[model samples]
Target: MSPKNLSALNKTHKLLLNKLKDKRTRQIYNKFEKYLNINENFAVAVSGGPDSLALSFLAKIYSIKNLLNVKYFIIDHKLRNNSTLEAKNVQKQLKKFSINLNILKWNGIKPKKNIQSIARDKRYELLLNETKKFKIKNILLGHHLDDLFENFFIRILRGSGLNGLISLDKKTQNNNINIIRPLLNFEKKDLTYISKFIFGFFVEDPSNEDDKFKRVKIRSFLKKLETEGLDKKKFLLTINNLKFSNETIKFYTKKNLLENTYFSEKKKLIILKESFFHHSAEVIFRSFTDVIKIVGKKYYPVRGKKIDSIIQLINNKSYFKVTLGGCVIKKVNQTVIVSKE
Candidate 1:
């Protein structure tokens, strides 16, 4: 590298680091550092919203401290007319800090219904492709404490299972990609303050306020709850207690998979002993999903209702063959086998 360019880079780094001198931002960084103990290079997903902008800043500072490479990407879903413009504006703003933001556009037919969920899926697809291109294993998200609370209520209204209700976690794996949310414990208001103070302004999404969306409605409902004495501290305590119980279930599910099923990697097959079906319903259900994930090569497993129906068919049949999750399942004698279709 030329000395001139090196000197310019150092100056920009110094300027970026100076932002942490502010007492409030420093406190937030300290708390963020405690949660993010990662040692490897990672990618940050930016949405131009306050939460994501704050994430880009925090992740950039962490990468500088750890001497690890970091990539920032913003996916323009192109769902709205102004999405491309917003993405470009965000990229221009981040450039002042020497943070080069990559813009990825989603080019496909727009969904008429379930737009939010489908757009989220597209964002992950683009981000996952970037990870594969760079061979990076971790992706940092901007989900905050408010998102966690909203997800909880959203799941409840949807009649979600216990697993679904508590699925919004700090760390989760999508296929082999590690999805990390370091700010899951931080409140949205604090993150907004950081973005506003450092970047001067951040883009806003109109969908966030539109009443047609369930999340928007839920956000309003939460504000009402707060006015009616909803204590976040107490709500957080309840979530923690549920997490403890979830862990217990996960332990048994893992045990069931290890003890009752055998995976022949060379054969690309999984063999399930008759005893696999003898465990408690939750354990059996979870164990089946684990196998499906492996054989299906899917990040998320098939829906629970379909799995339950298949389990019933397996139990009632003397001998059967069925296809699910790109896997061919057959019962021979007393053993069940699962292999790729």
Candidate 2:
């Protein structure tokens, strides 16, 4: 290797070491390392906030120590007037730490209503597109315990079922890539400390303070509840118990899918025999949800109410065909057939 490049590398290493001088920051980085013990290449979604900045620092340290490849990306949603500049500023700051960052833009039209929800989906879509292009199988996120709690309450407010309530797992499969959250057990304050001490700068998103958004409103409500003696430990325990129950239901769902349902070689068709509906309602509902998602190749499962309505149509003696969830369900003799619409 050239002497100049070697010297540059050594200098960057020294800077990273200096950032880790804080004992608490080092411990947090160690915990992050223990959680993300992967040797292959991966990418991190950096929003330039305290959470994502902390993630970038820890991921860089892990990559350097293990001789692995890790890329960083900032999504330029182009929502706000200064969004493009914000992305550039984040890129510039990380450059000082020797962490190279790429910017992905969201081009074209913007949503008028439900803006936050649509933007969130687009952000992941862009990030996952990067993963596919780079042939990487994992994408790390900056979600922490605070986000987890907020997601839980939001799902509840929307009348979510058990699956949706416990959907914020540490690791989940999205098509071929895995979405991992190593900091879900850590608090937001811990990450804030890392960003403040290491870089002394982080973006303060104005949307977080806007009460117009449901999430921001819930965050405020939770703060008040905490002051009113809400026990975080007990709340966490409740979520853990619910997760266990959800797992058991998932096991039965998988069993029913394997034992009672059959799929075509083309992977676009399914046949649920008459006996399929004989299982418990939950198992049958879950099994149907799986078939719809698989045949339709959709990222989300069909709504439960729609699935229940279809199940009713299937139970009828007369032949019936219905279309929903991008799939067509038809009854033939003693079996039900599902195919992409």
Tell me model 2's lDDT, rounded to 2 decimals.
0.88
Q: Report lDDT (CA) for all predictions.
A: 0.90, 0.88
Error of 1 at 27 (Å): 0.5
Candidate 2, residues 1-341, lDDT tens digits: the string is 79997899789978897767789988999899888778788999999999999999989888888888888999999999999999999999998887889999999999989999788878888888888998999899999988989999998998888888877888877777888998988889999998988889999999999999999999999999999999888888899899999899989888888888888957679999777888888888889988898887666677788998998888775588889888998998788999999
- Give the TM-score of each candidate: 0.94, 0.92
Best by lDDT: 1
Best by TM-score: 1
After superposition, candidate 2 runs with Cα above 4 Å error: 1-3, 265-267
Per-model tally of clashing residue pairs: 0, 0
lDDT of 1: 0.90
In model 1, the Cα lDDT at residue 93 comes to 97
